[model samples]
Target: MENISAAPETQIKETSFLSLNPSTLEVIGEVANTSREEIDDKIEKAQKAQKRWAARPDAERKEIILKVAEALQQNSKHLAAWITREQGKPLSGPGANFEMQACVGWTQVPASLDVPEEIVFEDETRKDILYRNPIGVVAAIAPWNWPLMIAIWQIIPSLRMGNAVVIKPSEYTTFCTQEMIKVINTVLPEDILQVITGRGEVGSYLTSHPEIGKIMFTGSIATGKKVIEASVKNMARLTLECGGNDAGIILPGFDVSKHIDQLFWAAFLNMGQTCACLKRLYVHENDYEKVVKALTDYSSHIPMGDGADEASILGPIQNKMQYDKILDLILDSEKNGADVLFRGQKPDLEGYFIPVTLIGNVDNGHRIVDEEQFGPVLPIIQYKTLEEAITKANNSENGLGASVWSDDLNEAQKVAAQLQAGTVWINQHGAIHPLVPFGGAKQSGYGVEFGIEGLKAVSLPKVISIKK
Candidate 1:
């Protein structure tokens, strides 16, 4: 059918800040809000291609994907610039090259994670061998935080395993994702990987569609729960990479003076929008004062402005609701008797900028301490014993990721082991590689992604018996 929605833009202007010239917030780009009918039609077209893509030899499928990866690498500069302008991030930073890395991973499909693993079993007179196969079509609904990188995380492995994909991006940040798809479609077959965009209604339609075999979604926990309920009719296989109120524990022996700089960057990168960003911190009471002082002094010095300015350290909150939520959490924190460690007033302008606010002595009762305030806000809670600390850390419904900091490696390892998070760090944050598996526990949702585990997620395993 070769069906895809024609991009509405006739002019390709630099799509950074779409509103005010001196605006604090970054605009990325404006999508010409699409309709549900158009999206459904696009899904039907992708479904047609998906069936044919499934019939291709696995090697033939990989050959076309390798070309897509090459195109991504070639246009990486263009892609990075687009990410900065459209996503309100720095021109160059830790995550600056992440999208490109995703492109490479998606296109190359590294050997370490390849499956098609053999299986064996025996029961008296019976013998069995195993096989792995694709799950028809895979559905990827991406979030805005890591737009293309997260999309690649889902699409690449799914495609590599011989499953076709229909990608639905967040409406708030769909332009760059759409443009990336356009560039990709320019070089590769459009039927294999198709881009569909709209608000919730369109997403709900495709997600609830009868034809989809499996669904992978990365977003809030609330939405994740809803996705699970919606898929029951089809009994679709699913992976939900939901939100988190991740913890960072500073152990008794870690010298606060020695690692304050490292801690600051970990807590504030991408203005703390990351799922694994240090949303909550538990410090031993003996070292609490020293650590808080260092964080306070260091945080006051970082400049804040728009992401495109090149000099700004923290950009505005990615969207509006996040802006209000950050402020509300701060107020609630203070009301619950926690100490405000920095500027609590949100930027008064229309742009969504909330000052980097760090609070301490926040108990579990407070929303700031308990909830996933996914902004550049850090809350500190003091713990008396290692038992209390681990108990408190694991108290939340979320267990997506957590970190422990200590110069005493043994003590840190002890606590990291006790914490009930999916991914734990010794002294760093947001340290992810393509080979490692990542996901969560409890209300943080379930399943894993990346590396061999991620590749396995894109398919179904089976047992094949051969005559002896």
Candidate 2:
């Protein structure tokens, strides 16, 4: 453990945060509590840079952003190790390198997108056109889970569309995000893309800053509201990707035994720390026992250990706050009479590790089923009919993502269409891509994150009409 307790920053620092190895509870590094003065300076620089960066031909901007993609691919190995160590996700599997590779794909996709002006009407009598103009100085705030990839999702399109971005990553994963920005800065002008580190107050300052033209955030809904409130100062554009209690429906006659592994990972990947992960599962009454048994068998074979261990598939809960929340939900489920079908074993280690937990026979209103647990624990509820399942899945305040599974593809598609979610999947969950438009419908969020629609969200639209 690197102890900087006596460091100068610690002596004068009003506040600071630590990045720990959740698998061992060891302090991996520390992030300074950046002042409002520092944040304002960075925003000023970004605003000045945005004018020049946006003035360059779109072709020139596209080439430099593509070079960033190549740099991310080249540094995949180093990033993977840092991610695993700082964030406690696996190193080899779907952990560090997997996210890095995905960043490359996400960065490259927007570079190829076309954001051309549209002519609505052209005639001898009149002419009408719509043009997309960049919103200057975007504030990109990313969460700890999927930090690098989500940061790319936020800034890539903004930059490609000609806006400069100031990114504030979660203090827990600042190391990797800082390095990622460093790699990108090699091809970008100074302050065009900058990384700042701090706590919640710092985020509040950035959101309230008048210079920030837009704020793109991904995190809890409570914080989303705060962001919205702060943005009222400047009436800055806001795109919030908030918390989700995503539900997965296992339709009748779907072979639970066949897709059990997919179901397990869909809910448990990244120790269930993902924002769009399936937190609640609804199974047909006919297949409830089979689904439970299949999940139990699948989870028993996987191990939870230190992220550095090659054999470990799942890592710790990433932070103490999340670990404690997962524990509270499990206790509440047990008290509410939900049966524990298979509770994973807790390892004798110092890290924040919780085993894969499946609580069955859970009623609809149980806290475990209602809230976004955001951990390794999942609640499997039973539904007597397709109508009941669809109703329960769409009954949440969150409308981020949902999935319907069945052997019959048509049936799955039909049920998927009725669910009130932004992105509905047939036999899959949380598989977001760069080309598809991903956003929330109701409380989950408002604006999109990918595709042309996403590009437009970061831009201000100007319409022109002329009378002949």
Candidate 3:
């Protein structure tokens, strides 16, 4: 972390820290390094505000949330550009612009969803009704990757369920989230939605605050565990979407020529910074060479450069920490005699840029194949039988998502069913819909996000019984 400078030119104060563009290392701006005192004050205010906010009619809350979506639409271009600059995702393609659109769409979808009262049991003499109620103030901890979109994922559903939110964005990408919260606050009532920006300690304070009734977090497994510990003090309800080293399996009869492009993007979308992107690929020995060759050829033509350049579809690694980690993993793989099948050419520019790379002749035990690289590197593993592929794919501690690729839908569905993941796709990887529920399994953390279940996750269920 960079220290606050007294230099007048940078205008960085002791109370705030710099936000930089990862591709250029230029200062995007400074965001407040919120103190623990400020966090406690914000949480207290949010709790007071939540009472009035939750008391409003559900229809009125829905209307206000829809207005928030409209406000986001009006400021889409400005917000998207800021996101590209601060977060290091390209402005076009499935980058910052796409993420802004997703923010609006996610907000609208949650607003439209209905968590109606349910009649769980009914008889002539007695009846029971289940109701969903707001859990008061919610603490949202968002990750740097997909910062604005993931913040939206946390904020909208909490607000839709009538809970006040105080978001603590990743220090690496704070300005974009602060900017987004600024836009959203224009349409929301005072103190209903707030952003407390800082490093990890700020988040620790916010999560541990006793006034907070629930927590919604998306980040690494290690951090999620810390959050769980913090929540224990308040006994806060938690919805944690943690790390995922998702896998994709290619069946023996898969057509590499027809689906090669989709497969490449599935793994490399957002420069493979996504939590659920295909990290490990298991290919049947019969189609191993064809799958490798097709992916290499397709990736060779894609461009990598500054996020501002419209021609560049892929951008640099978002920060120095992740960039160095990816390089070390590649070096370690090479030291262990893994074959580097294809490495893309980097743009002749200075930045935290890493070329797109694909490794072959790697097995499950290898470090590169075992851990989540979370960058522009994919390791291809070869298997002899479907059972072997399934076993190797399910061998990881992280099981957020997985996919089975084949022309035969029936066989693909069967393979999908056998995989140990929260969401399994037939031919697509990391394609999520706002209406469908998505989360992780095993060490990837618990609780679901999106749709009605997501809304319920942020709310409490109360059963009412009436005897006749």
Candidate topping TM-score: 3
After superposition, which runs of candidate 2 have C-alpha atoms over 4 Å from their true positions? 1-13
Quote model 1's TM-score: 0.89
Best lDDT among the predictions, by candidate number: 3
Task: Supply the TM-score for candidate 2.
Answer: 0.96
Question: Whose lDDT is higher: candidate 1's or candidate 2's?
Answer: 2
lDDT of 3 by residue, 1-468 (tens): 212121212321247778889889888887777876677788888888898899999999999999999999999999999888888899878898999999999999999999999999999999999999999999999998899999999999999999999998888999888889999999998999988887666777777777889988888877788888888768899998887999999989788898887899889998899999999999988888889889999999999999999888999898888999999999999999999999999988777889899999899999898888999999999999999999999999998999999999998999999999999987889999999999999989899999999999999999999998
Ranking by TM-score: 3, 2, 1
With candidate 3 superimposed using the best TM-score fit, by how many Å does residue 113's alpha carbon deviate from the native?
Answer: 1.2
**Could you tell me every candidate's TM-score relative to the true structure?**
0.89, 0.96, 0.96
* Candidate 2 global CA lDDT score: 0.85
The ten-residue window of minimal lDDT in model 1 covers: 1-10
lDDT of 1 by residue, 51-133 (tens): 78778877777677777888888888787766665566555455446556666765575423457556578776667876668
lDDT of candidates 1 onward, in order = 0.74, 0.85, 0.89
**1 or 3, greater by lDDT:** 3
